[model samples]
Target: MSSPVTPSLTYRSPPGPLHATLLAGTVPLFLGALLSDIAYYNSYQIQWSNFASWLIAGGLLFCGLALVFALVNLVRAPKKAGRPLVYFLLLLVMFVLGLVNAFEHAKDGWAVMPAGLVLSVVVTLLACVTAWMGLNLRSGGPA
Candidate 1:
């Protein structure tokens, strides 16, 4: 009697070290910005807004590099149908919103409070979600 052969499974590779590092870096910078925004909202201190602006810039730099890597991976991936696509799109949204948040932070005085705070919250949440998904989800298929 012939024995049945087991099927081979192939799983999507995780992001490279640089990509992973960039993704990881976004969270803290954005979170710091959010915290700074909150402090500014409560304390009315101009310095807090300055801190938030700088943090948001740093987050943008890291996120933009990660976005480029995601795009390259999506293009190179054998099958472009699932998590990679979602990750790219989500990262794109996060970057755009982060840019908007940066613009909001550029405003002077009390004008930066409510809108800046709102944008910071949204961008920070997006950063967390993208970072989690980018690191954890693996797309699998036949070899």
Candidate 2:
């Protein structure tokens, strides 16, 4: 009689869950930044609602924390961690650019006061998710 077929398992697991979580976090954080920017279009003050700014600020905080957490765990991980690290570096660049842009906004009399900041926060969120995905998948996999 032929032997029953058995599926083979590998040293690593699929990264679907981590991918989903990254997407989940990214959507909200990006949307929060976009929405906050849209709200600023309401009037000439170019100011944002305290609540909205706070939300974006929170997103930034969460993203920073997530990146740190991910990097710490990436020691045991494989090549997947490379992409996430790139994302984190990109995020830092975006943040620094945004800060510089803030000064430009002050001089240019732009209608949106925090336009640069909002975009920076969005990038941060995306980077965070990428980092999380890399860390969770590879870290938990076979070393």
Which candidate achieves the best lDDT against the true structure?
A: 1
What is residue 83's positional error in candidate 2, in angstroms?
Answer: 3.9
Task: Output candidate 2 Cα RMSD.
Answer: 6.1
Per-residue lDDT tens digits for candidate 2, residues 6-43, read 76533443334554454345446545655655665554
- The alpha-carbon lDDT assigned to residue 24 of candidate 1 equals 90
- What do the candidate models score in CA lDDT, each in turn? 0.92, 0.48
**Model 1 worst lDDT window (10 residues):** 134-143
Model 2 alpha-carbon drift over 4 Å, by segment: 1-26, 45-49, 78-81, 87-143
Write out the backbone clash pairs for model 2.
none
Q: Write the per-residue lDDT of candidate 1 for residues 1-143, one digit (tens) a residue.
A: 99999876667579999999999999999999999999998898899999999999999999999999999988888778778888899899999999999999999988997999999999999999999989975665532
Please estimate how well model 1 matches the true structure, expressed as its whole-model Cα lDDT: 0.92
Q: Which residue pairs of candidate 1 clash?
A: none
Output the lDDT of residue 38, model 2: 60
| Model 1: per-residue Cα lDDT at residue 65 | 100
